[model samples]
Target: MAMFRIFLGAVFAAIAIYTIITGTSHGWNLVPVFFGDMAAMNWPGQFNFDFFTFLLLSGLWLAWRHHFTPAGLLLGIIGVFGGMLFLSAYLLVASIRAKGDIAEIMLGRARASAIGKQ
Candidate 1:
């Protein structure tokens, strides 16, 4: 799972870089073309990328630090699977920020299993 996450993150980062670079070349309204309405058009509001990115990364971080359960798991899964072909760069940063929480959780589980054997 971790390996998968890392790979996905790398891919996402690439896309984000591409977007940052090419995004302005095309009309800002051109919208990205990808699987999940990658280029969907919408009126900018609080829901724009600036806000969305912050919320998503923050949520991912929180999800990792704490037990986000069904919803968090769903978000991670969606991010890993659904997000790969789209804006990967943003997800990459999010995954990087999330690494510590993920590591801590995995370590805790490892210790639990190890102690349980004794």
Candidate 2:
């Protein structure tokens, strides 16, 4: 759990720094560049497609984790668009809130509590 927290922190920091640097240089207009790569149908495009699928899965998991409530749906959208920016921080916080409980970390509070009762 400690290692996982550390890893999430490192991922958040690294991605934050990279985003700042890239945004400063490119002015944050990422949608076009992101899709443009896919349109070109090359290696970067292939990688982008793969990455997009992962984002979709991440979003879906987040929604499912919260049982697809309104807030869960909102989180799912944000997870897709915000990507690691949202996820790393979210996981870091969730890890802290879960207090080393892997089930709680993955399942959210209510579900985790229900499982615990079982």
Candidate 3:
């Protein structure tokens, strides 16, 4: 599990680097596209909303794990400005913190049940 997390972290880090270079070169015009591009609105708008929902869910999960202040705020920043690159990286680190405990990795300590999937 640790090895897998490390691998994911490395991959996400690489993706983040690529995104940085590409987005910088392209000026990262998400604001205009998100607000004014009506002709190209359908897919982009839906994707944006869905991705934002994931970001909120990720933040909520982090807060549930007792990282309310910093983690939740950082999740929003990274989600809105950085994208999946940071979230994947965050999840990788979180998996390492779980320390080979699949249950802990899959379900946060506060939510993991001792009995079954009930």
Best by lDDT: 2
Clashing pairs in 2: none
For model 1, name the residue pairs that clash: 12-88, 12-89, 13-88, 13-89, 32-38, 32-39
- The total number of steric clashes, by the backbone 3 Å criterion, in model 2 comes to 0
lDDT of 3 by residue, 1-118 (tens): 7578777878897897887898898878767765554346687777777776776676666555554567656665555555567667766766777776777765666556543467
lDDT of 2 by residue, 3-117 (tens): 9889989998999999999999989999999999999999999999999999999999899988999999999999999999899998989889888889988999988999899
Question: 1-118, model 1: which lDDT tens digit per residue?
Answer: 4776788777766777776778678644543332224234544543455555754665564356335778756655555433444434444444566463544333334443565689
For residue 48, model 3's alpha carbon misses the true position, in angstroms, by: 1.5
The local distance difference test score of model 2 is 0.93
TM agreement with the true structure for every prediction: 0.30, 0.94, 0.64
